[model samples]
Target: MRIGIVNDMPMAVELLRRLVVSTREHQVAWIATNGREAVEACRRDLPDLILMDLAMPEMDGVEATRKIMAETPCSILLVTASIEANVAGVYEAMGHGALDAVDIPSVGIAGNASSQSARLLTNKIAMIGKLVRDAPSRASGRISVATDPSPQRLVAIGASAGGPAAVAKVLSAFPIDFGGAIVLVQHLDAQFIPGLADWLGQHTPLPIRAAQEKDRPQAGTVLVASSDDHLVFKSAQQLGYTSSPKDNVYRPSVDVFFESAAQWWPGSVIGVLLTGMGRDGARGLRQLRDKGHLTIAQDEATSAVYGMPKAAAAIGAAVDILPLSAIGLRIIEACGRPT
Candidate 1:
């Protein structure tokens, strides 16, 4: 894969270069000293992926990402010195189409922290590379029509990349008496889950909290997957997190959770696949649709990144492909008011 590096610090750039070269699977396509230069470089020559620094001179990574996505779209991964410090900027970049974020691996370090950072960077790049290579071309596809005979009472939502804000928008539309429980799986770092839950709760009428082990879904409440382990439903009334699928790329995988709902939830389920960079929820949404569940995907026009929904639409997994604004209304119609 051809990867571009964008950072103002010389040492950080070199470290990233070394890491990319060491992998052998990827080569540095270009290097930019600042955000402005990165934007110009992308306009001239877009690479398969970009490792972008949040803070830079002339322009910031967030602005650069917005421009690049508008001018010459490409996969972008935020590589910053401190993720906690730049969490806001990280999410902003994601809202502008950046795929994910990770702390830049430190130079001349040999400890476990350094090793873990290195592994995370490499894994993220590889995963994004696959997403780019396997992305489906846009084409009008057929939607499968299916409906369960059982009463609908569960809403499973899956999102990534630009999910936090999108999830907030959807949840904010639900009334305090929403009829179904909402189970959400978002691809976020474990440390940020609580912050995200708090952030979303401020904008929504329904109660939002992290999913707990053995907890059952409750109407009018949004239970978010909060751990690095994948969240799954062991039965119709029980939720649990597990590390069994350690090999999966995205932890708290949307696919894992959606599949579990398909297996255990006999009641009518509504599966939603929102803006994201990978195909995690596509197949699982298909599984739900096959079982007569109503499935929806966010349309490309309103999605920050159209990869996941595109994949779902390609496979006829989504029964309806609507824009972001319309999704909330659709959910309400399907699930009805909280009982």
Candidate 2:
């Protein structure tokens, strides 16, 4: 895999460079001193992936990510000095289609997690490299149509890459009495789930929290997949985590959740596929639609990556291909009226 490095600090750049070179399967494609240079470099020569920093002179990573995604459309991973400190910028960059965020590798004098951090970064890079190679085609090939009947109502949403910001935008439009139970499946590391829920809580009137074992989706509250394992409906209306699909690249896969929603949700469902990279949610969304449910996919113009929704749209999964701003309202109308 050819990887690009973008950071203002010389030490950080060197560290990243070494990390990339250390892997026999990966090599450094280019290096940029700042976000501005990154955008320009990306324009000139796009790599398989980019390790981007949030802070830089002239242009910050958030704006740079927004631009690069809109223009060149490359894979990006936020490699910052402190992910905890730059939580807002991390999500903003992700909303612009950056894949994931991690703390920069540390260089400690003695006993510390420096080596582990370095390993973590490499693992993230490898995971992203695999996703890059995956065919971004119609993912509805394996999903089977559901034949169960239901009287309740559910909104099952899936997003990746630029999900946090997009999800927040949609969730914010919901009124307190927006009475449908919501289950969100977002592609991200498990540790970040709490932060995502907290961040999203500030944007909407509904209570957003991490989904736990035996949890059932309820009205007026948002449940986010919390484990690294896949979020699925283990039994009727009971949400649980599973590690069965050991080879899935996107952990807590959107497809898994949506498939569960299609099979187990004891009600009318509205499947919403939002801004994301790859075709993670397309199949499951189509399954929902096949069961005579309303399904919405975010349009390319409003998407950060446009890969997942594009895949969904290509396979005739979405009943409506709407922009980001209009998705929430559509869901509310479909869900608010009790099918």
Candidate 3:
């Protein structure tokens, strides 16, 4: 893939450059020190993918991404150190057509700098490449259709690093009246909970809203995990949104929600782990599979960040590992009439 990287931090630039070189599937098409230069570079060269930094001098990544999307319409993956602090801005960038954001890697990890960076960069490049190539058309293809007569099955979704766009793609494919409660756990900040919900609501038919404390799962709605809260299920299928005071490092943790649903919903749940950067959902999805629930992992071919789902698949957690486009159909089929 032809790639462009735009960031002001020399350390970040070096790390990403090393990673890109190691991937071998990617070529650094351009390197810009700021968003203005990034926009100009993209406009002129039209690289297939861009690794954009959120904070930079002389125009921010958001505006530059907007302009690049307007002019060149390529993929922009945000490489940032402060994803928690910029949830709203990141969502805004995704809404403006930036494909995904990844946490900036530390330069001091214990490995050969170039080789390690190259591996990291290669994984990200491939993930975002697929999302950029596939998500736009998938988003455009969403429609509301009548649900078939099947048991009331719930949709369980999990995501991480570049999950926002993937989550939007899956949900936007369904109508507001799509039969089943949709529970989503995306690693995000408590501060940007409202914005994330609101942003997704504007693009999908389902009422994308934050999961309220003690609320129950219901059909015709999409429930997002609140910032800093692990959305769990209580007795009789009620929602439990509470601070995760345990050892979990991820707020709005996917593992907790997926595990809780595995216990509470049992055979009726349909679990999905989409594009992400970590293994948080792997164990939980495994639990769901043990309980006879149907589980699906987004295949490497259609993931923006394949870490989470790939991890799940590695553990044999999924009944199938399919592309992004086929996932909605699988969910619809799961909610369809019995044979």
Candidate 4:
């Protein structure tokens, strides 16, 4: 991968340069001292991926990520000094389409250039590479549906790219007595799932947590996919994980979970496809619609990346294509209110 480095600190830039060049699969494309420079450099010569730092002189990473994604869209990984300290900003940047975040790794003694953090960065880059190189292609396998009656209503959501904040905003609107069981399939690393749930729990009235193995989605609570493997329904009412489609680049794929819900969930369903970079949820959402479930897709004007929802709209999968603000109320209208 041709990687770009963006940081104001000279030492940080040098260290990132060394780190990026350490592996034979990667090469340094260009360097930017600030967010503004990074955006400009991207316009002139965009790289395969960028290592973006949060704090800088002219512009910060959050703004740069927003600008870059809005103007010249590309892959960005937030390589900041302290992810713990910048948790809010990290998600904010992600809301604007940054793929993921990681703290800068320490340099080894005498410039040895080897550490656990180094390995971590390498692994993150490798995963992001797969996401960029491998777009979602549909498989031919079919999952069987159950005919048994289950009284639980369901709300299944899929998101990526700029999903964190969007999901938070939508979930925040659901009242405490919200009637439908909620499940989220966001494109993220397994390590970040708990943090994402905790962060979301803070903003929403609903209880939020990572979905455990064999857990069933319950009303008035949110369950998130907790593993890198695809979250699925083993039975009509039993949740489980599977690695059957190993070729998918998006771990915890939305399509897998949504399709599982479409096939298995017996009650009323509302499928929502939020902002994302790819078309993972579009096909699954279509399946849900074909089953006569109410489906919603975020409109392109309000979407950060607009790829997933746009695909949904293109195929006439969404029953209502709405802005982010309008989606929650629609779900509440369908799920919270009894007809």
lDDT of 4: 0.85
- How many clashes does each candidate structure show, in the order listed? 5, 1, 4, 0
Rank list by TM-score = 2, 4, 1, 3
Better of 2 and 3 by TM-score: 2
RMSD of 3: 9.5
lDDT of 3 at 91: 76
Q: Report the C-alpha lDDT of model 2 over 69-178, residue by residue, as the tens digit.
A: 87888899999999889888988888888999999988878523378899999899988888888838211111112211332678888999889999999998887766
TM-score per candidate: 0.88, 0.92, 0.64, 0.88
- Arranged by lDDT, best first: 2, 4, 1, 3
The residue pairs in collision within model 3 are 19-117, 19-118, 190-227, 215-239
Give stretches of model 4 more than 4 Å off: 22-25, 110-112, 134-151, 336-339
Best by lDDT: 2
What is candidate 4's lDDT per residue for 1-339, written digit by digit as tens? 999999998878888898889889899999999999999998999898999999888899999998998888888899989987887888889898888888887777876445788888888899888767653421101112222223367889999988998998888777776777889999887888877887888888778989989998887778999899999999988899999689877788999988999999878789999988768899999999999999999988888777788889889999999999888888877754442
Pairs clashing within candidate 1: 177-338, 178-337, 178-338, 179-337, 179-338
In model 4, pairs of residues that clash are none
